[model samples]
Target: MPSLMDTYIENREMVQPNHANNLDTVHGGNVMKWMDEVGAMSAIRFAGKSCVTARVDEMDFRRPVLVGDTAVIESYVYEAGETSVDVYLRAFRENPRTGERELTTESYFVYVGIDESGEPSPVPALTVESEEGERRQAEALDGLDA
Candidate 1:
């Protein structure tokens, strides 16, 4: 089994585009795409198989990432079901040169594990041993309640 820390940042990306948006700032769709990709990677790492997005509870583009800036997204599994892992995803806009960052977006996603046959397969429960993990899990539950 991969260590807990390994599950946190495995196979992520730092996306930079021509600009944040076609008009001027970053595009909302591009941010969503990045979120989905990072979320899926967390699920696959935890489940040890392929996974697909089952649902996104909520996605909010609170801020815009400008062009030439870095869109750094972090994804980690916070909760799990028999065949699903709920991932907590957060994105920040960073100045590539200065390394300054600001929270730009966040969302909760649910993904289901798939076996070699491409059928839903069971995934282990999420194990939260640290305060941070617990807080993130709580945030996901609180999000569902809202």
Candidate 2:
């Protein structure tokens, strides 16, 4: 069994000119791309197999990452089913100089494990070993109600 902590993933990308929109902030699509990549990595770590995006829950762009800032993405597998895994994803804008961080986006992503033949495959069971893991799982479940 893989614990949720084992599947934790964090990544950061510097917002460059190419990554920004007309407003000089990171584009929403670029942020989504980053989220999906990190979310898939978490799912693959949990499942120990190839995983593909199945769905993405509502994503609200609450803030913006300026061109000189860094986009920090965090993800973890919070729930699992027979062949699917649910990942909790959050992104923050961090000031490279000040180290200040602000929440920018959040969403739930669903991924399905795939076998060697590209068919759906069973995923490993997720074990919540720590208080934080339990809390993350609970958060994922609570999101379902919203």
Candidate 3:
């Protein structure tokens, strides 16, 4: 079994011109792609196998990440089923120099572990062992209703 915190992963991407729109804000698609990549990493960590995205719950863009800002993507496995891992992801726009950050986007993703032949494989159960892990799991579950 893997503890929920053990599956946590964070990635950062600079919002270069190529990744942004004419308005100078990072594109919505690019944000989603980053979230998916981080979420998959968390799932793979929990499952110890390759994982494919099964579903993406509603995504809400709270703010925009400017071209010069850093997009920090964070993800963790909060729950797991027989062959699936449920990950919660959050994206923040950060000012590199000041270290200030603001939430830009958030979503829930489900990934299914895969075997060598690409068939669904069983995943280890997720354990919320620490207070931080329990709090994160609670927050993710609560967010589902919003």
lDDT of each: 0.79, 0.94, 0.95
C-alpha TM-score for every candidate: 0.85, 0.96, 0.98
Q: Give the TM-score of candidate 2.
A: 0.96
The ten-residue window of minimal lDDT in model 2 covers: 137-146
- Residues 1-146 of candidate 3: C-alpha lDDT, one tens digit per residue: 89999998989999999998999999999999999999999999899999999999989999999999999999999888999999999999999889899999999999999999999999988888999999999999999877
Number of the top TM-score candidate: 3
Minimum summed lDDT over a 10-residue window in model 1 is located at 10-19
Write the residue-wise lDDT of candidate 1 on 36-134 in tens digits. Answer: 998899889999989999998768888887777778998888778899888888889888889898888888889999988989999976677778767
Ranking by lDDT: 3, 2, 1
Estimate candidate 1's alpha-carbon lDDT, on a 0 to 1 scale.
0.79
Error of 1 at 76 (Å): 0.7
Which sequence of candidate numbers ranks them by TM-score, best first?
3, 2, 1
RMSD of 2: 1.0
C-alpha RMSD values across all candidates: 2.5, 1.0, 0.6
What is the Å distance of residue 42 in model 2 from its true position?
Answer: 0.3
Badly placed stretches (over 4 Å) of model 3 are none
In model 3, which residue pairs have backbone atoms overlapping below 3 Å?
A: none
- Give the TM-score (vs. native) of candidate 1: 0.85
